[model samples]
Target: MQRKLAAIIAGDVVGYSRLMAEDEAQTYSELRAALREIVEPAVQRHGGRTFKYTGDGFLTAFGSVNAALEAAIDIQRGFGTCPLDLRLGLNLGDVIEEDGDIFGDGVNVANRLQAMAEPGTIYASASVVRSADKEHVARFRRIGRRQAKNIPEAIEVYAMHPDKAAPNGLARLLPARRLSWSRPRPTVLASICAGILVTGFIAAGSWTERAAAPPAAGSTSGSLRATAADSRPTVAVLPFDDLSAEPSQTYFADGLTEDVIANLARNRELMVIARNSTFALGDQPADIREIGERLGAQYVVEGSARRAGDQLRVVAQLIDARSGTHLWSHSYDQRIEDVFAVQADLTARIVSSLVSYVRQSEAAAAVARPTADLRAYDLVLRARGHHKHGGADRAALLEARDLYGRAVELDPRYATARAYLGLTYISEQFGWPTADAAELVARGLAEAREAIRLEPDLPLAYQVLSFGLAASGEYEGSMRAAQRAVELNGSDPDSLMALAKAQLRFGAYDEAVENAERARRLHPLAPEYYAYIHGQALYAAGRLEEADEVLAECTLRAPQDPDCLKIRAAVLVGLERPDEARAAMTELLRREPDFSLAGEEVGRRFGNSPLMRRFLSDLSRAEAPPSAA
Candidate 1:
């Protein structure tokens, strides 16, 4: 048995047996279904290992105390307003492993902690508290003392108050970092970092840095110009509130944000947060510094939109995340039909003032859509939301696909529809029965490119092209399309995430990690997919220990995931626990007999060759494997 100190976690349904007795069939069904959907995935996301799947609950193992607390919080959040509740217990100490089940005082303490906990609460021992660097950030308060059965001493406990406080460690920090909305003094330090980051990569063998992000640039400025710490460039774009009651005015607001995003991206000398990340924070009043720090930016852009009959109004502001000062402010009122012209003209002016030598190719695409396509364009925007922003189970994608289909049917030459259709294909692949990865994907991608040809100026064309390319495994091509998409709309988190994944897959390991870190910060609640890039980045950097921890997390955190189980097997093998590794492998093989050792591949897919290398090296190191042989 491997002797190791670990964090043990115990959780159980608040009233499982009683609920069952009340309505055995319905209650059991709901509990089972919810456990699989919400509880299990949350545990995995918070980096917990499943030691046992209780008939109605779970006994989890975590290596890090912080991770254990996080898992509990996530479980609460994932339930999302549901009345279901869970009780949690956690302790950090040495535990003996026997046939994969843990033993000793640590496990006992963990179980006791849960048994004493109230419904919907996480109770952790003092040992777990001391291990945390930022436990206070989660608003977990000391809960006096308790005596556990057979425990030598009384233990101090802590409980998370998720309802009263922000549920995440980082989200808790959001209130303090406000951005100004009326001034115009944008910093350019981030742009320097951006430049240095890009310039560092002009090589045939470009991807060099592996462990951490660009070594903090000793570190490079986001604007790519090295500077003293006091002066750095950063920006954030706030969500534009729609003031119109009809809700139809949303497009005008969304369009404004998109336009501003382009204006920001055009500043080659400045670092910019991708729009998707910024808009994510716009829905609520957020701490700009926290948002900027996480988004990897120095400034923020925020605004609201309203329409009264033919007149449309948009109030926009850009704020410095660090200083909480507004760098610029403006308001526009125009006819609804003229909103397109408003975005184009405003973007053009903002560019002429802030950026010199605006690219002609971009300028051409910035033109407002013709008045004839106004109503149809709204459907396109709605389709965009459905196709991209929505999650795996979001039904909106079907409606989006159909709408885009109709939009093109109504206008055969509409390049946007073609690109959108391509985007929809990528969305459909997330589900098994509804998934059509081959034929539909090919046609969708072809249409994306045709959209580009027909509408070279539209960012959506590039965005769709990027997603199609990535979905098709054209990693390098996808990176190019994604890069172009961001160049066209730097504030779009979706584009950056797409770009980040492409870079990770194509061996641009360093850049991939940097961009992915940025994307994760902007969209912390990224449904399940966030773990993919985060876990891969850890693995690529040879952080196998950490990667194993994260991979185990994916197993439950990501609902209905094929790769979660597969990834666990791969990372365990990397950690040299062949027994645990094989167990994971056996489970995967049950799901897929053709499963290969290539799962060990970090940046690249490992085939039989890497497997042979690993097998030989491992056997050479293990006296038992040889003695048995």
Candidate 2:
């Protein structure tokens, strides 16, 4: 085998195998037609020789990198009315010619890049784009880099957006993307119910949505582009194995897993991956490296739980996913009553091992007893589990609310349980069409404030208060409470998220971005609202391009989320993509026909900032029903 400089092209039919399985003869015919009528000719015209065909894909190489890319673009553009969608990858590197066959990292890298590309999209390595002609470079829009399968280092990737060619396409120097999180914005209704006077005061006219100077600190990188060193040491707690003989004990195991995640999440020093992402892995036996790469976690915590009679046995281990080294291991054989203590011990050990600057206050607060009543604690854990079970199901929310209320009833002094109860109430109210939006907010706010009154220092209480105050349209007050929570425990993603949301409202775009980024780094699998808030901040700051990217992802992650759709539509409007924005608005209206941002409630919620005024104007221009714009 002799190595020589070459330009590699990898092309594959999107969902070709699935298409073939459905209609073998028709798929085969279409595939052959594409290869014979379009693909082969394009390669030949570019002076590229087709080396091999692997069912749905083919490998080609050319002397000129620009020619290979031009071939890829032409082949993609060739599919005008054709139903078949193709993904192409181009890379410039040295390849090994072996016995009339081409092989090497160049070919592999091209394939990996192709696999990462969207259907009907062309992705190229940085080397390919840099070596190609200026004309070719002008067509590229750097989406971001990626950690491709089996690739030792991250590959800088660029997408060919020939359809949206602009004078300056994706030329902005952007930060690298990393895995972050997001959720939809909850509807905030101003309480005006007679006989129910709201006592909270909003610090109005104190803040404006003016673009602040960008801070020298904080990374602007997308979650997909962020490196591990850019943030904290992230960890994912995989679902614990159920070793119990009784089938009903599954809840206990799930509760234990959630408890561990919750306790670990309290220490802001460690970035704990959300349970949703970890639970999605299911029971499959995956490589540590794969888990790390997928979850962007440096460490993974896994264990098995069993209950025999009145005794409980749990074995847990923490491993470094990068090196596949066991960092710590522990086995506990304790009564069911000691489960909480065991969870605390495990969390403390993991934090101490992974982080060097665990504040003494946080460490002490981390293991602080929520309640001595084991039954109440168990109820709270089960309630939390129900709440965390995927989307906000009304039944689940009700069940969790009832359970949390019972937990608090059983242990009157349980501040954590009370705080969670309030949150569960808020979850129950989120988008509930039947309830009085204002009344629900009032109830949730009352519970949250009571939680704070019960235990003033409880971070969870303050976290809920942040949400409550924001729901009450007290953005400044909400931000202060959120900041207090962060100061108390800087590792809590919820606190950071709350702070970011408040900052966004008060028009502190840069600070909002910084906090949102930190929150996302903490829980890379954060709620869809996290992404929404970050995008809002970017949009308010006039960074329409970056905001478009974040909002696009938010919509993809949660298609039915109205907030994501609204922001995505707004971002599209900001970018002057009217048709796309209209399509997004159509989807939003279809989902939420009553969607209107110009309502009095919305106006009061989003204060009167120039950016808010602009957003309202944009929404109105997009045909969103205007209340009083």
Candidate 3:
């Protein structure tokens, strides 16, 4: 049979080996199913033919590039739930009746292009894209050009999203690493707590009402419209993996990781993952797609770190997390103090390479707020400064508050801390301070005000305001604060999640469920927030079965958690399982009797929240309950 000119398409899993090692059967089953469901029918619709499955991936050919691009879009739209994502590359070339398979530079180009395309995306060289006539084809947005092995000069490249096959709505996601504020030495945390005292509760002059306008902030709306990377090639620095013999060295490696995060955070073109989220991946291998989805990242920077003697070596690799392949890898050798400088050098190199590879006007728009006053390390230090103080110690929070205050003081524009400090003030009222209700409310508002004034764009700041307002009995005011936070960072799983939880405090059940679903989709492994939001929402809505399942998942994720155990008691009672409910309450009382008292007090704000009401009622009626006695 004579063969005509065909557009060749090639794509394979980027880190199949790593994925397999972690989960073999699950990965293969999903991949095969995706191919059958999404891949085959897609190219067939485009007048294309799919041969056999190559070992790890597959090969396909189309008569026209337009058909191929359309086929790619169909596949993405068809299969979005699979664990592993695909990367596709297409080229125009010829194939002959040689062996049972196909050959030529077109196939080779597509194969190599697969290596270049971001995961869950399609990429094509100019040679291939130009072949598709505009009338016959969809959209195409050029992301960059690449120098092919045998081709002369660089090949222009365009990327097409699955749904936006025509290429008019191209967007990006980012994955990144954050440094933990923990120390190798536990006692050191105690000293930090002791040094920092209760300035967390200074009173704010006023609190906004429900109808008051939201503060002017950067972007947190979660909408792709204001991604801030408009023309600039955006990137993400993923969390670093620890590879040390001693587990304690995890902190040291984490410290270096923060160094990288800080080094890159300074580059406005790049989007660094917040530390709170990054540390969530400690020692756990993550699917690249999952990472990209969670952080809303376009690129993922990852590496491992180890410390030997006075010398340290950190190995880092940049991955198109969307694709899950090792794009570039290098090692850094440095002394402890010099480690910070090495991160700066690496960032400059990676960014320069992106500039060279990309033809976009720039990497990202002028989106980063300025932070000139505080040394970046202090930010990292504060995160650890508070958490390291084991449990409900006031000293640690005080230190954290001071560090956060100084951070905002030094850089009035440092929005991240402004959000965190607001949370601190609200947390202080959780019995962490001796302040009365009026004192606590005033102080929490003040901290929230300062935070928003510094970073009006910070979703977390808005979230804190929600928490503060709700606790102080400003029901409607808290609701607006939660909504504003959502608008600021709708794309951020954490932000969406916090807003959802806060909405529960205001009796907004529908909005709460919607945000929780969004948050769960973006970051499926969110340990704390995911469980709390949906479980509480379901409980509030009287969906006892759904609430039970959600709480069960929370227990599976964190079996030892007292809060998870306690929350389940209310669900059990709703299901007419009082004995089970008593068991759950018994577990809760064992951990902290005072929890019951707070639950009782908090129940008034959240009507129909069975968990809080029962926990409070159970404790109040029980002779053995410590809080009542």
Candidate 4:
């Protein structure tokens, strides 16, 4: 046996035993695939070798501590939306290697640390943290000292901050991959600990208080809004199948289905069928096309849920009911401490996925439909296609505004159309040169209020009102409106995004970043504006690298968007990349020839705040257009 200093990594699947119990062959195959595709590849990439496989876990050795920690981080991120959850631990100490396997206190300490880690997180010994590079060390926070099983002395541990693990360059810009893995069950202690942590993270500040309040007074009673001849695509969410070993778990499945239906109804874009209408068909499986024809739905959302001990597995799919084509599908496996918590999260994820797929499918269909057949809802849908592309396309923005106006004229009671019409005015106020800013702001505010009057529970109306208020310099009112939108529908990405933007304008940078991140998490396939807002929040909070990464994604998605280009240029300047910043500024100037540093537009948006100063300084450094100051 040779003793030498090495960085050791220990990783274990969180619920390996439960996975095997459910399906031994499939579990074994998935474990092998994970090791081969994710774990081993990451290890190799970071100059590590998997020295041993501990059945449901693995032990890896790296010559460098930084490499070991990086490898562990990469492996954890690689799991992404996959059902598998891994706990990783790293230690730097003397190890005994014999016959290509490691042993001794180093390996033992790593195993103990791995056992202590929460699911999808990394824990490292103080020695490892000390040996790591400064950049890597900064990403971890001390977790105090802990006594390891069979170890003589207490060891100091550090946990990596979840948000600090930045994706390399534009990697995070890509759509999340949908991968399947056998579900694992967490230990009782781990489950309770994770539950507490999740609760604390989610229930921070006033948001939880607002979330606990009852729905707004004028909320509808969960009925389908669209009629039989409604131009918008109609969606039906069927009751989820109970795939558990015991039939008693059907309640959980049914509750999840109901929650998903309710959440989808909050989105004004789609006409969601009421739970009663879909659940009336019973739990029997039917052909997608036949179900669509019977229910008069263009799309169908179907899924199954399984409960095993304290763990739950949910598999969902979005289908084009007309063609019986599966548009998207994903599976979620989570440890359940509170059934309602699991239901809420599962519902949000499912609804977000369904909305993205449905919108894409609808937009494609709308493009093919002739203009003569367009109705208020159809016009709004087509308008959204233009609106989401940002204000760089002058013709498109004008077209979207016109379409929204026509939509409102056709159906004055359509709160969704009016809200979007208000949003267009606000967008125009910021994006274009306007002679009567007060009139634009007034019109925007009026439309938003009218929409709210028409439908008080409509989160979109509240979101539009928040934007309009912000543009009118009513920060307090803007915040209240944004908060109300979130309180009404916390799962809606648009609501979260509106709140984030309001928070940013209100000088709550950290809160802005948190809300924007939450929005991105909910809607992985969200439009470019999501990235723009998230990057803006990060930039405001002085997180330059993260802001740079996110803004890069925003520019890639909408290359001509002036807001994205402006922010990207500022971030590049902050990062001290003068040439890149100059390049970005050149592109920005190409898009907006009248851009200027001392323009009233900047003051109108940012006021005299520190963020505005920083934004100006960065732009000035990038050599933006000359100011008339």
List model 1 lDDT by residue over 72-108, tens digit each. Answer: 7766554433334566787898998889888888888
Q: Which pairs of residues collide in model 4? A: 15-184, 15-185
| Between candidates 1 and 2, the lDDT winner | 2
Please state the error at residue 222 of candidate 4 in Å.
38
Deviating ranges (above 4 Å) for candidate 1: 1-232, 247-252, 286-296, 345-372, 433-436, 457-463, 466-493, 499-527, 546-565, 578-629
**What C-alpha RMSD separates each model from the true structure?**
27.7, 22.6, 20.0, 20.4
Compared with the true structure, what per-residue lDDT tens digits does model 4 show for residues 541-570?
Answer: 888888888887678777988788888888
Worst 10 residues of 2 by lDDT: 197-206
Please give the TM-score that candidate 1 achieves against the real structure.
0.51
What lDDT does each candidate get? 0.59, 0.70, 0.58, 0.70
Model 1 error, position 127 (Å): 64
lDDT of 3 at 350: 66
| Candidate 2 lDDT, 1-629, residue by residue in tens | 79999999898887667667766777687778778766787788779999999999899999999888777776776643245767788888889998778999999999998987665568889898779888877666543335667889778776663342311212221111310112211210111111011100100001111112121122223532432233346788998999999987787888788778877765544556667667777477899877876777889999999988879999999999989999889999999888877888888778778765443333434565768898898788778777662255788888888998899889888888888877765555554634376677677778878878876667778888877677767888888888767655554666777777777777777777767766665555566877887787778778889888888878888798887787778788878889888888889888887777644236333455677777777776667776422
Off by over 4 Å in 4: 1-411, 555-561, 600-605
Give each model a TM-score. Answer: 0.51, 0.61, 0.49, 0.44
